[model samples]
Target: MFFKLRKPIFLLLSIPAIALVYIFLRNLSGYSINYQVSSPCACYKCLTDSDPWFNYNISENEFNWWKRLQTESRSFGVYGTTVANFFKIFPRNPDVIQPKPDHCRTCAVVGNSGNLRRSHYGPLIDLHEVVIRMNTGITRGFEKDVGNKTTHRVMYPESAVAVDDNTHFVPFPFKIQDFEWLINASTTGFTGRSYMPVKSKIKTNKDLVMVVNPAFMKYVHEVWLGNKGRYPSTGFMALILALHICDEVNVFGYGADSDGNRSHYWEILTNKGLRTGVHPGSYEYNIIQQLDQQQKIKFYEGLTKKM
Candidate 1:
């Protein structure tokens, strides 16, 4: 009995020593245990995968669920082949690099709500390390309200826009044809018919193109939005994407404008009845509000006009 009690006590005492040695080694390897424990955003658990790049190992169930989110009718085999071809041409590099403990990366997810019209948020928006704009969001002629700096642009074929060589031209591919369009658009120019007319060849640096993972998209839909609407909107996708890549996120130009209109800030509105169409706009906005309430993100509603 004496021997057993002594042995157990000795083993228990060794635990702290072992832990100290492990922590010392981790420090020597430039990994921070404290930062790992303390630095995650409030919704870090919801945001999985440090790298949201395409992989061939996506399961059939995931594919089926994600494909159903869009109106695409391509078979699983065709999707797989297209992804394979895409990787062959484009390097499967991680879009956002692993964050260091010393770095506090801030991001801005700028939407195209008309509320940003005279907000004068340019200087503030440009301060972020990463500025992610989406879907035909132009920075010209409105640089005072919307900053000229665009580090990443989230788009699909229908909402494609031109970005400088420095910007990461991220395509939120909804179908196999979208992948095909990216490949052909960069090389020989796309000629295939899509649901909407897409530019045959967009003037963007092919090397800077990044495709959003279908699995990540599915995660944003099911986990974040609780699978609401037909699928997640590009604005919502960019906001969630910011959560993973940024230590702190500041959102701007979502929801209705100062006049309570849902039109783009860049265009004049004739259709007052226009809504987000297929996306669950109100539900997504609620999620954003929840995140803001939880201090996970800073949502800037912009300036409200006075009567």
Candidate 2:
């Protein structure tokens, strides 16, 4: 009778003691559910030990990478801020997004190689919110290839060509003296390398230069050369940049025609005997086809099919 009564009392005492010891050990261990506390770090990396400065008023539990991605995703097509700042110093004015519309913003990108002189796609190409062309090859003749709807023209401070003042002009400030050197070079009436002087001073009436994102450029090179196993050219990068910045990107006069003939769209004689100009290699073309298949952008080939 005495042993049976002691057994019931010992069992009751053992249950609470075990629970206390387990609680003590859990508090001691870092990974224990009852021990490891919430972190203060704002970066998305979790399961880390570093204690960052956490906002006391903000809800610690609410912060996460998913939340940040969602926020950043909304601001998706904006180009590099670093590139935009370079042009801020010269001709302090707002940059115009061409084919200017109140509701939808569209761009038509034109390349200079004399290929666009008479393609007659100019009026149709003008249907965009903005029309972007590089260098100064705009004329009414090659309307098909160059597109007559030139809204924005990109130029270097050192371009060896002249662009009409009435149209919107964009200067690419790639280097430190891009604005100063190019502007000075043009002002001083000295044509050096890739720049030509204007006859007279014209009013600066254009938006900021559209800058190439270094990160985006790296992404393109990596995707093409390192990942896709090919070298990407300047025009290929330009197309990629348009795809990233604009909502709807349409490519015209890029690469050779449908028959794999190596010819210049600009028709500038590069010694038809010596070397045929090339835009993209077969591997880069494959990557572009992949991008098109993924519906990342739309590519239209203005081919005569006579090759």
TM-score of each: 0.81, 0.52
Write down the TM-score for model 1: 0.81
Model number with the top TM-score: 1
Clashing pairs for predicted structure model 1, backbone only: none
Q: Across residues 1-307, which tens digit of lDDT does each residue of candidate 1 receive?
A: 0000010000000111111000011111111111234544443422222222222355577668778766678888888777767766665654464565556678899999988988899889999889999989998899999999999988999889878889988888777788889889888999999777999988787677767766566656655566688788999988867865677789999988777779788899898888987789989988787777766578998864444
Question: Mind giving the per-residue lDDT tens digits that candidate 2 earns over 48-85?
Answer: 21222211111112212212411322211121232233
Whole-model lDDT, candidate 2? 0.39
lDDT of every predicted structure (CA atoms) = 0.70, 0.39
Worst 10 residues of 2 by lDDT: 4-13
lDDT of 1 at 115: 87
